[model samples]
Target: MTKMMKAVVKSKKAKGAELQEVPVPECGAQEVLIKVKATSICGTDVHIYAWDEWSQSRVKPPYIFGHEFSGEVVETGDLVHNIQVGDHVSAETHIVCGHCAQCMTGNAHICQETQIIGVDRDGCFAEYISLPAQNIWKNDPSLSWDRASVQEPLGNAVHTVLAGEVSGKTVAVIGCGPIGLMAVSVAKASGASRIFAFDLNDYRLNLAEKMGATDTIHSMHADPLEVVRKETNNAGVDVVCEMSGHPVAMDQGFKMVTNGGRVSILSLPVRPVEIDVTNDIVFKGVTVQGITGRKMFQTWQQTAGLLSSGQVDVDPIITHHFDLADFEKGFNLMLKGECGKVVLHP
Candidate 1:
């Protein structure tokens, strides 16, 4: 009989998930089976749990659904050489085809043939997960699982903040989600002159402050654009990291970026958003970057260095922890925006 493992399964085409015992995934010839040690709730996971429009269209029910995680390799396929059983690890959730044009060009992170773990297939929301060997990332054995599990999202923050020059430049992180909060810390560590964090949630804004935000703007209480203008002497911020996904906030980010500055967007907006192209892009000479996953492994190196060197401490941002069985509690806090990064221990 196949070994059974506990997993949070999206068993229906509805607004929640179920805890069930599922068969452990088999390690393929070029794959590894990891024993999940820690996992975290992502905004995408929340969407799947809530069965949002994106989830409805992209996710298939009766499957496991989580991606951000750290684990130990429990088994390795016959063809796997880089990783060995007993190695502590995490994975790049994206399984990209090696022969794709983007992959061949060293831009595999944006490979058109990318298949995400949680969204496109079985994910890490279980005790064990089988992953492609190429996607495995070795972790420092001494690193805490909570911190290790969050590296994926932190890489997003790093990639966005480091997309352009940040030293001595002012940055506005538009959105106070976990990734947004991490962006604030990354900006501070990268020597950004000022870091303005914007969000409607006071809870998240407070977390941003703890994460080293120079100023936290509760959009519900203040006009974000006006505040940015007032604080910057009407010149505007030098860089805007858009993680809000809200149309209004995204527009504000464009409007508040100084001419010739950069706007790096990491959030995925649910619907199409209209913008003043001439004012926001053309005449302003602003550079707009659509940031996706971490730069294949370059961003990973930066993120690991920052975390290991104490330049960027994520302890303050990871506000909660729960056993894997209590995942619902974690999701509830995430849904309410009342917590920072929530980690789950298996």
Candidate 2:
């Protein structure tokens, strides 16, 4: 008889998820079965819940649908090594093909054959999940499950904020979503002399200040470009971390970046965005980089160090928690933009 567990399943081709009993996933030869302790909602999860264009194009239904989580190893497959049952762990959501060109060239995060756990396969919004052994990241025993689960998105923040030279520089983070808010702390930790955070949500802007943003701009009421320029004596910011997929935010970031400065973008715009390529890039000599997932293990290492050293604290960013059965409440908070990171216990 198959053991059954409660999970949030995208069982239909429409909006929302259903919490139901499903068979526990089995560990593969090189995988480990984890007893999920805690999980968090991400922007990606919200997209799936809403059945948006991206989700319609990418997500196939009748699958479990969460990726950010921390758990304890309850079982290991025949070929698994080094990791034992009882190990506390989190996972790298991007599962990459080792033989791909990007993987061979130290850019596996953008590998041609990469599949995400929640999007491409069964995921961890359940009582248990089976994941590849190589994707498991052992957690510090003292780390709370909520914080441990967030390391995945934090890696995205670290990769974007630290990709450019930030030490002794001024930075403008043009988004206050979870990753954008995390960028504020990452910038301060990495020695950005001054940090300006922009967002339409007052809740998130206030949280950004707590995360070490030197200044916060409520984009709905104020002009971020003008404010950032005036704040920097009209020189503009030395770096721009574009974390909002909104076209306006993208334009604001490009407009506020200093000539010859760097712009690192981690956001995924829903549609084409108009920008003056000649003025924003060619003439200004601005360096633009499109950032994706964490750099295989490199960004993970940096994320761990930042957390362990107390340099970047995510405590304030995690504003809500719920049990697996009450997942809708968490999703409602997410839809309202009233929450930061919402953690769920299975």
Candidate 3:
């Protein structure tokens, strides 16, 4: 009899998720099967559960959804090398086609034929998940699974925070969501002199404070640009890391940036956002970088070093944890903004 594993399955056009027994996936020639240890609820997961427009447009139904995770390899395919069974690991969720123009030019992170694990295919919201061995990143056994699970998002933070010059600079993170919150730690650990975190939610703003944000601005009462100007002594922040995806916040990030400053945007704005391109970029000479997935192994190396060195701690950000069976509860917690990073154990 074939081995079966419990999985969080989303039926076609399904509204929510369900736990079911499914066949453990067999490995492909260059694949490795990982025993999932921990997974995190991402904003993308929330979008999938809600079946929003992006989900409808991109995600085909009858697919299991989850991506941010860490695990231990339990098996490997014949062609798999470098990764061995029982190796502790985390994975880059972006599966890029190596032959694409972007890949051939050494920019594989944005390969035109990228297949996202949780979105484009089945993912790690199960007992086991198979991934191409090239995407696997071995985690040091010294790190806990919860910390390991964070590497994916941490990579995003690393990519954004390190996109341009940040050392000895003042940085304003325009959102305090999980990734935005993670950016605070990344900025602080990367030698930013002062880190300002802005958010509507006091809860997330508070978490940002603990994550190394020197100043927290509640965007409800005061204009973030005013606060940033005042805080920076009439000058704006040296760098603005925009993660809110909100049009207004994006504007504020530009307004709060000093002339010639760098603005790294990781936010995925649904509708087209209007920017004062002529004034913000052309006139001010500001450098606006659109940050996407991690810079492949480059971001992973920085994230792992940060985690391994204990320079940036995520233990405080992980405010809640739940078993895989309690995914709903975890999802609800994330919905209410009741916590920072929430983990699920399978």
TM-score of each: 0.98, 0.98, 0.97
Using TM-score as the measure, name the better of candidate 1 and candidate 3: 1
Instruction: Give the Å error, residue 197, model 2.
Output: 0.4
Query: Taking the tens digit of each residue's C-alpha lDDT, what string does model 3 give over 242-330?
Result: 99888999988887889899999998776789888888778888998988899889999999989878898989999889999888898
Candidate 3: misplaced stretches above 4 Å? none
The lDDT per prediction is: 0.93, 0.93, 0.89
What is candidate 2's CA lDDT for residue 216?
A: 92
By lDDT, rank the candidates, best first: 2, 1, 3
Give residue 233's lDDT in candidate 1 (0 to 100). Answer: 100
